[model samples]
Target: MKLLRVGPAGHERPALLDADGVARDIGGLLGGAEGAGGARDIDGSLLADPDALARIAAADPAGLPALDAGLRIGPPLARIGKIVCIGLNYHDHAIETGAQPPAEPVVFMKAPDTVVGPYDTVLVPRGSTKTDWEVELAVVIGRELRYAASRQEAMAAVAGYAVAHDVSEREFQTERGGQWDKGKNCETFNPLGPWLVTADEVPDPQALSLKLWVNGRLRQDGTTGDQIFPVAEVVRYLSHFMTLYPGDVINTGTPAGVALGQPEPRPYLRAGDVVELTIDGLGRQRQELKPA
Candidate 1:
């Protein structure tokens, strides 16, 4: 099931894309019927509820109201607790950045407030000239996991997968004398989801291809296959350090070919640049850059 949320930002209603590609209202099944006072958002609690998921999966698309085609799509999951990121986790990305592959994952974070709808406008911070793009595979957790003992245990905790745009400002990330989060947590930096494909549909996270384009030109073309620390191990490794709870997201790094890896006059993003990215089996995202 390709689950999503549609309508305007903050006023989105939970929906699911059906077989014929229609967005069907499932908000009723979640809390109460469509406009009921007790409507619920798709969040950590819903991800942890098997019965709710079962009900949604079993719903008939024909019986549900279809959303208007013009309604905006929001990040599939609401109330995202935290975003854990792996840096230089891809062999090619590490090589491009001229860094050695670490024996363990390099983790950082983006506060939840940085998230925006996939198709929303991305802000190019004022006084910035090194805005860069990274296409990544985002893993959404559905279960609480602590000190996972094996890959299987970690895999079991995943609820779904989504494409994430890990936008960055190179100067702030490296030369600004601070952690990567300095550049990473800028407003609207993380654009996520047109859909959240359930884990069962993905089957293999490492096999998905990730691609990104600036304007109409291709910039990043890499795969999870090149990841230095694969999904299962990364999850398992992180569980030992922090509790992985439902709605927590893990951005499993990006593949090579970012503007940062290019030669002099590296084609960094500017105002009006459009970025589009996708992951196989997951959905795609497109955003236009604008001045903050």
Candidate 2:
């Protein structure tokens, strides 16, 4: 099942793309059918239900108003509370940046305002240098959990997955006096979507191929197989300290080949440079870089 939220910003509605290639309106099923207070507002548990899924699968897509291809697709989750990230989680990415693999995952946060639809333009903040792109596999938490029992149990906590471009500004991230947050939270930095593929549909998250391209030139080309800390372990590791609630997002880091990792060290994006990225089975995204 590929779940998506479509329509203009703020007016977006819940929708599901069934296996047979039909789009079903799940907005009512997600509450509001009987008005407010219906079914507790469709969280991770509701999404994981076999019966609910079957209903969506069996839905008649006919006359459902073929979704406008040009409509904006927002983040699958309407109200994302936190945007957590992992740094240097890919072995090749570590080596590319001339750094050794860390003993444990390096965590960071990007402001929720950075979130945008998959095809939205990525803005290059004025007077900025070192803007870069990171193609990542984003994990969407399906349940609220603190101190998960084990790594295996942690995998069960995932609602689904999506393709995310962890856009960054290297100067602000490394040169400025502060944490990586300063460089990562720029408006329109995180372009997510295309569709959120359910966890069950992804047989093995670690085995997927992921890549990114600037304009038509390939920039980041690697795979989740290169991740030093796989998805399950990442969830379990983070849960030991902070709680992960439904709709919370975890960007599981990117593979090698980022512009920052280049030998000559390119800095910043120019207007008209388009970024195209994808993760196997998860779907793809294309974002044009625009001037602020």
Candidate 3:
């Protein structure tokens, strides 16, 4: 199932693109006829109800209203509480960034405000010249995980997955920086969606491939197969110290080929540059750069 949202910002409606290539508006099932009482958005609270998703899947998609392709498609999930990130999870990425593969996952957080529709224009922060792009596989938490007992438990807690662009500014991240979050949390920094591929459809998260391009140049092309800490382990490991809630996203890090990994004279994003990314089974995303 490829879940999505369509319409204008703040007025987006829940929708799904069924296997038949039809877009069905499921907003009625979410807030109108079939049910009520949740976050009023596509957050963890909505996904927490297994029954709701089941009902949605069983409904006749053809009966549901078809979304006009001309309408804007917003982020798949709404009200994201946090954007947790794993750094250097890809072995090649670690080596390219001049770092060794860590024995454990390195975590960081990107402010939720950074979230936006995957096709939105990304703002290059003021006075920034090193804006960079990272295409990652984002895991959407489906259930509450309080110190998950094992990797199996963690995998069970995953609701779905999506393509996420972990946009960053190198100057804020590494120079005069207190933490990487400074560069990570800038508005419009995280472009997520196109569709949230339910976890059930992705039996092995580590088997997917991901790619990213700047303008027309392919900068990153790698697979989760090379991840130093695969999704299940990363989720299980993080659960020991924090509560994982529904709607929270875990960006599993990028592959090699970011501007930061290049030699001198490396190029970074500038206004008008377009970034395109895709993760197998997750869908595609494209963002146009804009100056803040």
Candidate 4:
């Protein structure tokens, strides 16, 4: 099932995308009716509730009211506890950035507040010159997982997947950085999803294709097949260090072709530039850059 949130920012309502490609209101399945006692929004709690999910899966789309096609679609999951990101986890991406593929995954973090709607405007940090784009496959965790004993155990904790734009500010990241988070945690840096495709639907996480275009020109075109640390392994590996909660997210990593990997005067994002990205089966995202 493809789950999503629809409405204005900060007031999105839980919804499900039916087979007809229409967003159907599932607010009643969440808690009670639309507001009397509905779940505040789609979050870990709903992801963790198998019965609730089953109910939604069985819901009749014909009966549920269809949301306005013009309504804003927000990040699929709300109240995300944390965003654990893997850096240079793709072989080609590592080489492009002039770094050797590490034996272990390179981990980083992006604050939850950085997340915005899939089609929302992305801010180019003021005084920034090297803002870049990375299209990454995002994994949404469904259950608590700590010290996962095996890859199977880790995979079981996954609820769904989504397209994530790991927007970056290179100057603040490498040249004057204490850590990558400084460049990663800028507001509106993470435009997450148009929909969350359930894990059961994505039979092979590593087989999906990812592509990003800037100003109508294709910039990054890659695949999860290139990930050095596959989704299951990254989840299992991170479990040893931190507990994975139902609402937490993991950005497995981005492929090669990011602006930072290009030659001199690489096409870094600037105000007025438009970026559009998509991951097979998950969904698509489009954002226009603007000065902060």
Candidate 5:
């Protein structure tokens, strides 16, 4: 099932992209009828429900009202709790950034507010150059987990996957005397989702090809197959240290060819640059860079 949210930014509504590629409202499924449950945002509870996606898949698109012709697409889900990241999880990425692949996953955090619609304008940090792009596969959690016992168990906790642009500001990251979060948490840094392709539909996350381009010129092109840690292991590993909850997102990491890994004098995003990316089954997301 491909689940999404549509409409203006903060006023978005739950929707499903039917097989015919039409957006169908899911408000009724979320209890939008009179006397129905609270008209809550498409939040965490929906992600945790096993039957929710099945129902969405079965929803009749013909009976629902199609979205207004030009409404903006919003992030696929609402109330995403955390934007977790794994650094250097891809073997080629680690090598390109001049580091050895760690025996374990290296983790970081991006403030949830940093997330924006896939086609939204991305803001270049004030007084800074070195804004960069990373094409990654984002794993969304469906179940509560304290410590997943194995890779298979960890995979079971996954709800779906989406295409993600893990935008970054390198100067704030490596230059500042702080964690990588500094560069990662800037507004509009993480542009996610055209749809959250359900886990059941994505059979093998590691087999997908993800690529990104800046201003129509290709920059990053690699596959999850090169990931050093892989999705299931990373989730399982992180579960030992923290509780993984519904609506939480884990950016499984990027493959090589980021601006930071380019030789000296590599150009970064400038105002008016369009960055577009795609992951095989997950769909594509584009962003136009703008001055902060």
Candidate 6:
């Protein structure tokens, strides 16, 4: 099942794409008619429910409006509580950045405000040099958990996954007096969605292919197969410290081929550069870069 939120940013409604590739108005199934019963507010639960998915699969989308032709898609996970990220999780990405594989995962945080729709515009921050792109697989948590007992247990808590672009401004990221947050938290930095594919649909998250293109030129091209700490392990590892709650998103790092990893060092995004990225079976996203 590919779950989505469509329409204007704040007013987007819950929607589902069935197995037959038809769009259904799950907004009603979510809560009730008029989006009542507070079911619409429980999208996370619906995604985790087999019966709910069945209902969506069996739905007759004939009468529904044509999937909101003008709708601007938003991040698949609504009401996100946190945006955690892993750094140097891909072996090739590590080597590209001139760093050794870490003994353990390196974690960081991106401000929730950085969240934007898959096709939204990416702002090249003011005075920014080294703005870069990272195509990552984002894990969406369905249940609240702390101190997860094992990787299998952690895997069970996953709601689904989506394609995420972790756009960074390197100067602010490194030259600033603080941590990577200074560079990673810029507005419109994280563009997620196109769809939130449920975990059941993805039997092996580690085997997926991921790629990114900037202005039609390939930038990042790699696979989740290279992840140092795979999805389940990442969730389990983070749970040992901070609690993973429903709707909290974790970007599982990116593969090699980022602009920063280039030998000559491209410093930033310019107006009109387009970034298109994808993760196998998850979905794809395209965003245009613009000066802030």
Clashing pairs in 5: none
Report the lDDT tens digits of candidate 5 across residue range 1-292: 8888898888888887877888888877754223113465455688776566566667788888787747888899788889889998888889989998898788999988998999899999898789999999999998898888999999999999999899999999989987898889999999989898889999998899988988888898999999998899989999998999988999999999899999989788888899999999888998888899
lDDT of 2 by residue, 186-281 (tens): 999998887888888898999989988887888888888889999999999999979998778899999888888887747346788888998888
Per-residue lDDT for 44-79 in model 3, tens only?
777888777887878888889998888888999988
lDDT of each: 0.91, 0.81, 0.88, 0.92, 0.87, 0.83
Model 1 stretches astray by more than 4 angstroms: 32-38
TM-score of 5: 0.96
lDDT accuracy of residue 33 in candidate 3: 30
| Residue range 207-252, candidate 4, lDDT tens digits | 9999999999998889999999899999999999999999999998
Query: Can you write out model 6's per-residue Cα lDDT over 1-292, one digit (the tens) per residue?
Result: 7888787877777777655665556765544332233336434555556566677766676655457556787877776789999999999999988999999999999988899999988999888878889999999998888999999999989988999999998889888887999999999999998898888899999999998888888888798999999999999999998998877899999899887888774635777788899989888899988889
Q: Which pairs in model 4 have colliding backbones?
A: none
Q: TM-score for model 6?
A: 0.92
lDDT of 1 by residue, 1-292 (tens): 8999998988888999998889999977885322222467787788888988999999999999999989999999898999999999999988998999998899999999999999999999998999999999999999999999999999999999999999999999999996888899999999999998899898889899998888888888888999999999999999999999999999999999999999998999999999999888787899999999
lDDT of 5 at 54: 60
lDDT of 3 at 34: 32
Off by over 4 Å in 2: 19-22, 32-54, 63-65, 265-267
Cα deviation in Å at residue 139, candidate 5?
0.3
List candidate 3 segments past 4 Å from native: 31-39
Candidate number with the higher TM-score (3 or 6): 3
